[model samples]
Target: MKIIVDRFISDSESTISHISVDQRFVCFGLEDEFRAIKVLKETRIPAGTYKVALRTRGKHHQQYIERFKDIQHEGMLEVLEVPGFTDILIHCGNTHTDTEGCLLVGTSAHTDPENMSVSSSSIAYRKLYPLVVGAAKNGSLSITLEDNDR
Candidate 1:
């Protein structure tokens, strides 16, 4: 599976993006603002291609399994080996403040200069999780993060 995140709008506090899988639209994504100097929990990962996998262990995993009981949750969709970052996962949230450096997904998006947000987050996540897990099962999964929406 090939996932692409087009980070189109970036500001002081948030980066708003759209996500696609295998050239098909998936959802909107939200991440922390890009920063030359990395700040823990507040900086977006660098633009790069990274392998993705299902992280079966972690607090996020445990929480998701419970919260998404109807989805047959496999594991968190983790973006692997991002330089200077760890435990980067594609999950769900409403705003940049909820991201904590992880990618957040939603059905709809809104962006302003300093604040970016998304809505219907859990609904988006429920729709996305299975597709990623199925891909992981069938073959390889990877994601390319880029600033292409300019």
Candidate 2:
């Protein structure tokens, strides 16, 4: 499986890393717009087609352990599954003003010293995560982000 994120298109100063495998696509924590953490044995994901899955615990994610009780009951911290139509992703932003509900990268625009203001974790989640997750889950061998420089 291959995962790609474009920094130019991302909100500045985001930290992305740590990808995990569930039942479908490889899941990851979004570090930055240009960085993606993919789960595979190889250092680089081969360019091809593959499927994707998103492992989300839901809105009560802070109560993650209780949210996905079954997974947690089994002693697992992260929940794994295809995102389906939901735009849940381990992305940038915090639980405050910066997040707008999606996973965050920087604490917030004010917190990030680099002055990255255009990217929204929620927006990025809406625009990018689904497409990548969809491709990965549907059996697309390779996942690519064109880096639109948004």
Candidate 3:
């Protein structure tokens, strides 16, 4: 499976991207602001292609299953071998604050009334988790991140 994230909407606080699997739309994604210097929990992961897998062991795995009970399967989708980053996963959230250098999946993107940034999350994750898990089972999953602004 090949997942592509085209980051198109960006602001000082957050960046929003359209996610697709093999040319099929999947969801919107949220990440933290881009930074020239990496800042813990506040910078987006560097754009690149990375291997993805189902991670069964870890706090994120347990937390995801707890929040989304329907995800009773095995593991959370994890992005592997990102240089200078660790534990980067495609999970659930509404805003940049929810991402600590990780990707957040959402159904739609809208400016947050309070923050002037994008939100509307969780529902997309509910829809996406199962599809990604199924893809992982079939073969290796890889994701490519591209900054459309560039």
TM-scores, one per candidate: 0.94, 0.30, 0.88
Q: Tens digit of lDDT per residue, candidate 3, span 1-150?
A: 889999987878888888998899988888887898989888898899998888888887888777778766578788889888888888777777788889998877875533533345667877777777877765578899999854
Specify the poorest-scoring 10-residue window by lDDT in model 3: 111-120
Q: Per-residue alpha-carbon lDDT of model 1 for 1-150, expressed as tens digits?
A: 888899988878888888999899899999998888889999987899999888899898999999999999988888888888998989878888898899999999888777679999999998778778887655599899998644
The most accurate candidate by TM-score is 1
Per model, how many backbone clashes are there? 0, 25, 0
Whole-model lDDT values for every prediction: 0.87, 0.34, 0.80
Model 1: how far residue 26 lies from native, Å: 1.0
Quick one: best lDDT, which candidate?
A: 1
Compute the lDDT of residue 88 as modeled in candidate 1: 91
By descending TM-score, how would the candidates be arranged?
1, 3, 2
lDDT of 2 by residue, 85-146 (tens): 12333444442334322334331233243443433444433333444544444555243433
What TM-score does candidate 2 reach? 0.30
Q: Report clash pairs, candidate 1.
A: none
How many steric clashes does model 3 contain? 0
In model 2, the Cα lDDT at residue 90 comes to 41
Model 2 per-residue lDDT at 102: 31
